[model samples]
Target: MTSSGFEALLEAVRGPASVNVLVITGAGISLASGIPTFRGTDPGAVWSNEVMEKGTHAFFQRAPHESWKMYLQRFELARAAKPNAAHRALVAWEAWQEAQGRGFAVVTQNVDSLHEDAGSRQLVKVHGSLRLARCSAQGCELGAPRGTVPMASVDFSAFHASPSPETVPRCPRCDSRLRPHVLWFDENYTEHDTYEIERTLILARQSRVIVFVGTSFSVGVTELVYRRGRKLDARMFSIDPSNASLDRGIEPVTARAEEALPELVRVLQS
Candidate 1:
């Protein structure tokens, strides 16, 4: 927990009394909360790798009912999960930084609301949120941030295995099938959100140091955060259980994010 490396990195940035944005990605941070990463092997999934690769687009085209059921099944899983220690650490860091006339802008590739649930401010959810659903109909009357009757206040009971032959849910607004608002395999990201995320990365680059937590840094969106930090000559610290392909020439703290982040916050607070 006593990382002299993080201590030195903190000393370099704590002197500046301004917002210090921290860019992060999905994998390691959410593990403590029970969310699995791409390579992660959870007990088992309602949908397998094959189903996911086929995705909503393919399923809806060939088997509409099946796709809708899969979407609902995933939604229920996410709803049941709670925020974890790594998420709380980020929120605490932001609070402490704010007290010191500084702030944090967190841009994450996570679809889950763990960061928001952890009380982080100045957030950018680049991949959208799992809690939200929208009409699948293109340019349909249904819009962003879609709302619906509360699904029984989602809880532990909802994590049951998905029933076979997926059933589709409908949008009350337009009677169109409802779908998760998250980005999919064959889809492009939202331009507005992408621009805002890039803007935060630019700020993190100019920062004295950039801290990466739990991310593999394989995806372009997450990789850019580290790349920008390097461009600005910012000190870099990466926290993950294992080193990534992107770990070359960077200091790697080979530990889980849950273990590392709270410790980092404690040292940084001093």
Candidate 2:
């Protein structure tokens, strides 16, 4: 996108009439922060066949300790990484929009809580979060409110190298094995209301402007947002280096999100 087009987007967002802004984010937004993308055939792709098999609900149910070990390693990476410029820029934009009496919401596909760490208040994590863990038992009291334990507290060392069912961490409330609170590959979005996919869809339907940052638009939720935005005649913008095959109305800013977003925020603030 051109500088003038970006300026126009900023102006539209900054307008006085309470514009509703929707920011959709994916794994690419966190790449600059040293997080790897899960899919694609690139050297950086983190999702191998083994990784995909291990990330499923079936695998977790069959081998709880092994699942925990895999996720603990992944969560450790997210814990060590900090939010990048793109994340900070979105936080600033959200603050500015709120100050202007506009509505703003973030719908993120990323499991990493970088957006929350960067101070994005109005946000939803559709894929769930790696920061939390809950009991695996169905009838346990810990299942209702879903008491989440911090990943830091869990001693993953015991399960390292080789994991068995006996090595898995047990829930304090029911002695059932604990699992990562993230949505698994075998789970359907419609089956679980806990991840707040409905809330994201509502935001997509209401948004006047939708910004898709660092996404490949491969997932169902991202495609849902795209279709909804097109139907609502919402102004769409994409920040990506690759030529993402997006629909016509989307203004493509052919740059990395970390590069494009900071400039976009600067213009919005100015």
TM-score of each: 0.78, 0.89
User: Against the hidden true structure, what lDDT does model 1 obtain?
Assistant: 0.64
Off by over 4 Å in 1: 3-5, 41-48, 144-167, 191-208, 244-249
**Candidate 2 residues 1-270, lDDT tens each?**
465446666666766575899999988899999888777444656776476788888998887877877777778899999999999999998888878788898889898989999999998988878987777777575442345667667666667755888878788888888888887878767634557888988998888899888888877788888889999888888777774565577887678889877887787777
Query: Which runs in model 2 stand beyond 4 Å of their true positions?
Result: 1-8, 11-16, 40-42, 144-147, 190-194
Residue pairs in steric clash, candidate 2? none
Give model 1's clash tally: 0
lDDT by residue (1-270, candidate 1, tens digit) is 655555555565566665365756566678777766655544553234664665646566666556655666666666778888888888888787777776566778777778888788778777666676566776565544334223333321223354332345566768766665666655545422432555666667656656677766655666677667777766677777775454445666667888777887887776
Task: Please give the lDDT score for candidate 2.
Answer: 0.80
In model 2, what lDDT does residue 211 have?
A: 87
